[model samples]
Target: MKKRLLALCATFFVAFSVPAFAQGTVISIEPGDGVQEALQEALILAEPGSVIELAAGRYDFTGPLSLDIANITVRGAGMNETVLSFTNQTTGSEGLLITAGGARIESLAVEDTPGDGIKAKGVDTVTFKDVRVEWTRGPHAENGAYGLYPVESKNVLIDGCVVKGASDAGIYVGQSQQIIVRNSRAELNVAGIEIENSYFADVYDNVATHNTGGILVFDLPNLPQMGGHSVKVFRNTVVANDTPNFAPPGNVVATVPMGTGIMIMANREVEVFENDLSDNASTNILLVAYPRDYNDPTYNPLPRAVYVHDNKHGRAGFAPDKAVKDIIAPITGLPVPQVVWDGAVDGFWSAFFGPDAEDAIYIREPMGTTFANLQMVKDMILPWGASPDFDIDDYDGSVPSREPVSLPQDQ
Candidate 1:
């Protein structure tokens, strides 16, 4: 079977054609008996800068596939045409695990993985274009964690992708620098798109809906990277994110209230603007400090230097859920607000001295936009009941604008 597959690949090299600028060999693989062995062998034997082309068909695998050769391009016929089904996978965590630099995986779909659908870890210059990862069973706690996940990598570009039914996040980029996630759609996930503990990322031109949370920019504690900063999220359509949180218990995202459009937690120097947000029943946008107690002295739990401006909002917070419905709704009344900021600072000293000019929340929205500053810190210390500030004018032009993030991949 191996010899026959190799001969078939050679025949394909002669019969098929690649681009004129392709500097490497093209090894083609089609679905048939022993296809899992054929594809895995091709991936192992392929040299650097090779193009492993997969034909249009369903490829069944009982285990995971890994690509470790640098500068390899894995091209499929189309996202819907070439399906890699790991429904019966018995070993390995991810359907496809990529650890090589300069690897591009495009035009394919991975379905029904026990773990992550596709994961790129510790790679430099990786790109995922026109790919889709999904669970056929839809939203459930047993679904995979992430659809297209890139972690601890630099110079990442994820464009024209679709992800659904991820228990955690559909498109997640974490602990990476110089990243861009654009022209994507995510639905039926815990978080549609999440940029966590990353630096210099621009997430724009994406559609996020039907998830527990639409888009999240979070800086969590105790990681290889801390203090995530310099992110710009703009021009995204975030609406109707009313899916109940299906993450496993005790996960951080499990705390996310349903119907959250965009939530920013413990991130600095972030900007949110020009987004179309509507019908997100919890709130259109939430800016909050990290709610858990942490022992990391280096972690800054407050979100600072954040600016939100000129975002269209409609009919949000009308049907709040989870914490938003239980705790916040009683205080703020029905239709909680379009934007809610947990007024939490570092400590008593920072609260008494007032936040620095650069570490304030800035808001510039259209008229009739509702907002609230739930003075959580003040309520914790003082004896008075929650003094929720419902004014938006106090936060006008409070922080300096951030420069746009430019990536090497964009150039």
Candidate 2:
């Protein structure tokens, strides 16, 4: 991938008429005392197709640093050796912001920011490898909302990274396309990893623990984008995400229950398989509605065509909290099934066209893994004393696999 990125930049100059962006030129910044000034100067003077390398050291800054030049690579000696702390950041809401295409940021650490650690918006072919974004004060309400936030971007790849101590989500990808987030670790956040309102995503080979919710795939209303679908989440270790929800009020993630292994809400065609989810106090896997009133005509609040299969579940669904305790536990009892569905749907039509609608959450887990469909919609209907049909067989089918995301080589 490195060679491919390099070759793409090399071919860009030859294909175009830009010559000032010379090849074989590297800009090195070793700021000993004047860290902010050196970085600001480097960012302003950097040309396209150039590499901005920072030497191994600790640097403190008071504002955000952003790059707008295309085909730029910002690298450091190592994640631990080269640290950038934004404890006193006062200007921008993000520690490092990128608005350029074909940008590669690698091997660095960003700590203690007021807002987001690294926020890249509306960029294409942006990659973050071996990067660490953390809040050293540890999970406080004043901590950054997100460690790594990429929104409205295309061909995004985040690999081999560690993010922690976020008030909202450790790693959040929102309203993006063709995304891949793998081989990463997220801990001590409201949500470990959240893929929201996105399409064509593959999230796998990641570790999510010690947070409010291990992983979340949510689709909410009132966004630039709506009706996100076709995401694959598999082959991950999610356990012991029992952190308190410290997010500020009105944020979507603030409602996430502590000790949730994984929650899938208001999305379609999401396949979750081959994950090890255990030791979560609340629930192993949860499928529910959007849990709000919305008027968006395009936003579908029901989760449809979801396939959950072949996962290893251990010691989950014991201790409940918040809504799970007040509404779900009394219906399903403690140690709530291995998989719990809120049984929320789109009114009377759901039952009238029940098995044929294919609007279902499918599960094929191993034996001894309990399952429950809470039949939440029946509360408004008459004769609700008897349980509505919670048959697992009614919601059984296979969803097609989504195509793997592949970034454009030419950017």
Candidate 3:
């Protein structure tokens, strides 16, 4: 009797503990399969490392589809085919709120939420691929917060997503690291794509057009971690975004007459390169105030260590002679020759000023000091040369197309 009792206890322990050691299981959800039933079954039976596959249909959650399961993969038919929508979400409610790490929601469309479309909080290894998120609530305050808001998340990849009509921001990834946003389009929103308080991010080959502000990298204040540093915002096409009533209020930066293209604020060790920026209402790119309170615990300074090169912008608001003066010197408060190419200064002097008068700009530092790199000045600001767009050997048809360049990666 004693031996039998001991054996029974061991059997019970094995039966319970075996499930814990096993990997998560896969659960499938289909229209014909009863959506709520499958979801319920998954919630009940799913372990860690589970996958929940959904068929093509519109799923309206009577309540939130909150997944307590960790390391689960949710796959859908496609963005167009499968739709997960919420009509009535109260404050701070998301269409899909992912709290678990290593979770993925791919190839679906989520819309019409009270708060954010998808909010991934404190999760790691999250990926949203080919997903579409929109705030159908018009442009009012009732509109949802962000298309994708990943705060304090890591290794997040938001690729090929069409984010539209968010009252706040289309793609807002804040306080995250190793984030990659590629080939995404953000339109008809307050701010297009915002990567703030992030590091080691690569935002490439995206189109942020016709938003209030297009393609913003900011290290905003009033945050615990306040450095938007070591980012590569390259090869994006930003244009004609500054239609009024869409831009944010109380913004000190005005849209350039042509609209604002790329606005970099208080970020450090950043590189902005090989982008097509034009038709902004005010300026193509604005280097706004950096976060002044990051350096010391009390008072961090704005981002330093910035490199801007080989970008192509329309000549609507920017003139040949004043290109460097207006764009570079004003922000740096440095001399003329410090920013522009050597050829550009020589060419500007030749066309606008005689030899004696041309030399005067160098000596007097009208703004503050002489310009740098006369050749680049000639190439950039000088008139009647090959158009900056077409002159480059790898210039591909005024717009970004399939044609490759020598340094395709550089652009």
Best by lDDT: 1
Best by TM-score: 1
lDDT of 1 by residue, 281-376 (tens): 999999999889899999998899889999999989999988889878887898989999888887776554446777888888889899998877
lDDT of 2 by residue, 1-411 (tens): 244333322331221232433462466666455667667766766777777777788888998999888888888888887889999889899999999988888899999999899998999978888899999988899998999899999888989889999999999999988888999999999999999999878899999999999999999898998787888889999999888888887999998888888899998889899999998888989988999888888789877888998899999878876677787888888887778888777777664445234666788887777788877776556474436444666666676676777777323
The number of residue pairs in model 2 that clash at the backbone is: 0
Candidate 2 versus the native: TM-score?
0.91
Off by over 4 Å in 3: 1-24, 31-45, 243-258, 290-301, 315-411
- TM-scores of the candidates in the order shown: 0.95, 0.91, 0.67
Pairs of residues clashing in candidate 2: none
Q: Worst lDDT window (10 residues) for model 2?
A: 9-18
Q: Give all candidates' CA lDDT scores.
A: 0.89, 0.83, 0.60
- What is the per-residue lDDT of model 3 for residues 289-314, given as tens digits with 9 covering 90 to 100? 44223334542333345555567765
Better of 1 and 3 by TM-score: 1
- Quality of model 1 by C-alpha lDDT: 0.89
Model 1 / residue 101 / CA error / Å: 0.6
